[model samples]
Target: MSTTEIKRIKSKVKTNSKYVSLITWIVMIYFVFSVVMLIRAAFLPEEAFTATPGLIFWQITIPINAGFSFNINIPMEVLPNYEPERFQAKAAFITYHSIYLLTYTSVLLYGIRQLTYILWSITDGHTPFTINNSVRLRNIAFAAIGNALLAGHIATICISIFVTQIFSMNILNISFSGLIIGSLLLVISQIFRYGAYLQEQYDTTL
Candidate 1:
């Protein structure tokens, strides 16, 4: 290769290394934030945060992008003042919550596995690697799928929580909290993905 080409390659490698380092740092920060939130939840009373089991699940698995705004307009009469109707509604809520939780747990586990694979591929250095290029692509695909799953799950959970809040006539501050958290999660996810892309580009040039 020409001297100019060699310099360009070196520059790309340097850029990629920087990106990887930045992304790794961001992930560690996010994990620390999660730990802090978990600790707060453990210490605080139920009234402090008011995140239901499903909401907790959503918070735990930000990879799925599972937080979304939802409209909840329920008429008073339709809810039925009768005890039996209320009981039925409660039962339905329980069932829905159970199914979503189970699905999310499975998706979360898979997502973690995918993340590990991606991290492994990125960290693998100049050694004679046995794994083909397809492995990296496969890991990215798996991570994307996991993100999709989490998005759906988070949306469902957010909608449910919104509805419950409205039904209870609670304050509106929780929506803002969700919005802030969701935005942060999205940025972090993008950063990690972009870092990976830069790493791949740098590797290809080498």
Candidate 2:
């Protein structure tokens, strides 16, 4: 691409990044609110614990000469029972979810902060292919992967806890999209690394 085209792309990136940074801040605030709500819900009286079970439903359709679709709903008791042992179980569950939420939000905020930094660098007229930019991109890739893995681990623990103490059902959920996005980010980070190396060589030659 020509220099003019590159400049135009950078300008767009900077604008979009500013908007995304704003959204990230908004989400962070919402997360804090959610944490407060979770704590409040956990401490409510036994009579106030009128919560129901959570259900996971999935449907898949195949289109071909012979097409078939099936829907399945799996229900798991997410709310704590008011019994002594069950109430203890509920407290443990709440603690686990709180930790997971905080950790997940922290990872996302770090990634967003790195993205904001990169955007600011572009807006400040710094070349996009700098060593710092490459490092930031790599951190983002790791954060994405970490978030996905952490989510899966937390889900598994949740399922295990509920199944053993509250219900007798199986639940498994993992975000394939998150894995794909993380992989793509990792690839892009490598590209950025190469670009930074080339930029360094160019600067040295000049």
Candidate 3:
């Protein structure tokens, strides 16, 4: 690409970095807010939990053709008539929510930190393709993969708890988008490493 194009791309990356930084701060604040809210909910009066059912209705469907399918909605309200258990279930729900939020926020912040480093490197007038940047990219890629796995594990655990403990049901859903994106980033990191090697050779010839 031409110098102008590279400059434009760098400018864009820099701008996006600012946005990412803003989001990072916002997420941090929101995380703290959520923790506080969870604490408050945990301490809420028993009467405040009068409306929750310790159960979830899962709709399952299996497609046999383009338009034909079998469907079932399992409504498991095990503690429907038990007020104390329902209140306890609400507390458990808050606990799970808090745990999920903590894990998610931690992973998000770490990824954002890696991204911020890349953006800073791009805008620092240094050669964009360097060994350090390549490593940072690789780190971010691996972090993405780890984040996805951790999230899926946490979700599975929480779902299991809700299903078995609260409603005696069972279900699972896991997303692989992070793994896909991380694979792409891993490829990009290899490209950056190669670019850094070439840049080093060129500098040596000079």
Number of the top-ranking candidate, with TM-score as the measure? 2
User: Could you tell me every candidate's TM-score relative to the true structure?
Assistant: 0.39, 0.70, 0.69
Q: 1-206 in candidate 2: lDDT tens per residue?
A: 79999889887997899798788979788778667656665665444322233333211111112443211122233232333334333344454556556666777788888888888888887777888888898888877877766665554456456433544322334456777888898898889889989988988995
**Model 2, C-alpha of 25: deviation from truth (Å):** 1.6
Top model number, lDDT: 3
> Ten-residue segment with the worst summed lDDT in candidate 2?
56-65
Per residue, candidate 3 scores C-alpha lDDT tens digits across 87-162 of 3544444645555576667777887888788788889877878999899889888878876666655544554465
Which regions of candidate 2 are displaced past 4 Å?
1-7, 57-93, 158-173
lDDT of 1 at 150: 48
Candidate ordering by TM-score (highest first): 2, 3, 1
- Once model 2 is optimally superposed onto the true structure by TM-score, how far is the C-alpha of residue 119 displaced, in angstroms? 1.0
Of 2 and 3, the candidate ahead on TM-score is: 2
Candidate lDDT (C-alpha), each? 0.41, 0.62, 0.65
* Cα lDDT, model 3, residue 147: 69
